[model samples]
Target: MSAALPQVFPHAGLPARVTVYEVGARDGLQNEKATVPTAVKAQFIDRLAEAGATVVEATSFVHPKWVPQLADAEDLFTGLRRRDGVRYPVLVPNPRGYERALACGAREIAVFASATETFARRNLNTSVEGALAEIEAVVARARAAGLWVRGYVSMCFGDPWQGPVDPAAVAAVVERLLSAGCQEISLGDTIGTATPGHVRALIDTLGSRGVDPARLAVHFHDTYGQALANTLAALLAGITTVDASAGGLGGCPFAKSATGNLATEDLVWMLDGLGVYTGIDLPALVETSRWMAGHLGRPAPSRAVQALTKD
Candidate 1:
């Protein structure tokens, strides 16, 4: 085992450090039952920056009817404090979303699509192929405008309506996203049902398909309480980027019982304890999550950090 990893970590020090993309402001807030005010979003983003999160997803520029919580994407993007070194990525569903993001001075953007045909039709009002065609155009436009593009493949592990996604299907979508010029692609467990074994298998499949492991990211939700285990599996498989939300802010609207994204505070706590350098200030991150939870009239679900700091 390498000196950088704690003894407790499985496959300690094998995969090295990972880049954590913070998505509390966008994906975390998009599914909220109550629309969070723009000011609160800006403050939340500023606090995330103070906690050493470099890649913060700011908001989505989708149609208001689809995700009403992010209806003020334009104002929210412009109102936030734009730091020098940190990146603010906004989700753009189509060419129109990309253009709107551009108008708000967005330098980076994210595009998303579901792997299942049913989800594609329900979520995007189109088929998988149709959604991919739109996303391809969005990617080209964003790249031409000198923007960083991140592709998101939802339901990588499983879907509510579609059970047990095929690894081949996941690989195909990943290939298309990479071919369309997305610098990185994040595979999402939209329903949070992934296990460690499944994570390893999917990564292996993607790797075998000529997908560069370095450009792959894992976005896991903690609904089944297996996110951390799956994250460990991804790290062992050479995935370097992970997506997490601070405070575990969002839940699955499709599956009401599901919780939210893996909390940043919890991930950082584990990484720090394992001697992994995430470049995060644990105390500051916990404070941010606590504050957000309080503001939302709830408690944070970050068991690690909450327990560590509550004393």
Candidate 2:
């Protein structure tokens, strides 16, 4: 059984253990210009699980028209190694995608809704309410299949077209996803413009709406170099789950100007030093990122990985 890292002392108002939700294989690679081979993607998932990632999102079931890179999701899931305790969830936009994910043996699924109507239209060609309506059905169907459901609220903080967002608006979508039977909601900082104060306020808003921090996860981007700081705020606000991509991979496809995700390696390093257990193998994780970075023909963006692997 996995154990929490030993707490050296009492951490006032901080969680003892945090679950790092690794999205490297799915969220990390979805936006890449070069399409990764099916075999390579499977290998990456295996490596992530071997590095002690209990929840590794593998691939999305979205249509090829939306993300052609993950067109081989079925093939990737069919022959990949399944770790005993690790969960591999696929993104499903609608019922058709959910059905495809189910056929590929997916036991957990994720559906995303946007906070702003503009992002809703731009990302999925639907209004916020319309997207939530579709996700509700997907969640209901997946729950009926006894599959775990995760929901994502995109553009939770600020949007490119619609500058500055109301926390209540984000919470409204989150509530709809939860009412549809999503066990957890990931509030996504799609444009990477959220600050620590913004994160705290958003969490407070959700809390005020009867949403516990336990059922929430923070997904941040490093576009303005505030991802880690914002994450610290979430941790202080009692958030236990964090969504990160290995090697800091991934950028918003809809919001092209945004930078990559907050690197898992960087988050792990901070948590380790803070005595917050994540059960991740730091050196092994770094090695995997370096290897994956080599495949991308670039140096790893994670400072932790680069520092640990520096010549």
Candidate 3:
């Protein structure tokens, strides 16, 4: 029997294809309370790729003292049976982390930055300016090594400590990342307080700052059920890349209020209905998520996964 599919209704003004930057491996598993086995992590990445995800964030090289869940970064990255035509980008916190990724033979890497000072202090243990300064050096070195670098700007829409964030402040951080030789930037709604208007406004603000929307991506948390809505706003604003976790399985360990990331299944389902090509096999993706959830000993949080898997 064939799996169920959403009926296609072509949407005007939407891109022909969207790149789903799958973060289930690094971002998703990083927040887990239990340590997932290294082999399981490798299999998870391979399954996501088999399900047609071209850009899967493999793992982070942060110190185990910070994110202990991903302590096996080197082991996992070394044993990964990389697929053809798929890009696995790992997170590198600083120069030392970049060195680890480089030694692991990482071809692509991402650096994290924060827009708000409070969260920067808590998450990165530095001020916003200090974080940018450190990330600038890391990004420059990665680019010099011919590695594709992605910059992640967190707290773009809102911050728990600071409340509503100024879009202009977010743009400043983005401008620095672009200046630092980052190939792309993923704006993070870390607290999930963003509305559709706020999402569009931030992207517009970046555009006015001479940052092209083409070089941007959106990373939304679904704490308030607004991830999909904010994503729609970004898509309409000509942003194509989106960061999502399989089975909706990630939250910021540093930010207690932050919740699970926008689910890959949910995003794919919506894009499928809108006739936006993602090249993903929905049933295969769901099965992969379900498999991972079994390892986590919980049901998948994705609405599409729950509904479609009901017997």
Tell me, by TM-score, which candidate is best.
3
Error of 2 at 179 (Å): 0.8
Considering lDDT, where higher is better, how would the candidates rank from best to worst? Answer: 3, 2, 1
What's the TM-score of every candidate structure?
Answer: 0.94, 0.96, 0.99
Single out the weakest 10-residue window by summed lDDT for candidate 2: 1-10
The lDDT for every candidate, in the order shown, is 0.85, 0.90, 0.95
Ranking of models by TM-score:
3, 2, 1
Query: Which residue runs of candidate 1 sit more than 4 Å off their true CA positions?
Result: 1-13, 254-257, 309-311
**RMSD to truth, every model:** 3.4, 3.2, 1.0
On residues 145-230, what C-alpha lDDT tens digit does candidate 3 reach at each position? Answer: 89999999999999999899999999999999999999999999998999999999999998988899999999999999999999
lDDT of 1: 0.85
Best by lDDT: 3
Q: Is candidate 1 or 3 superior in lDDT?
A: 3
**Which of candidates 2 and 3 reaches a greater TM-score?**
3
Clash count for each candidate, listed in order shown: 0, 0, 0
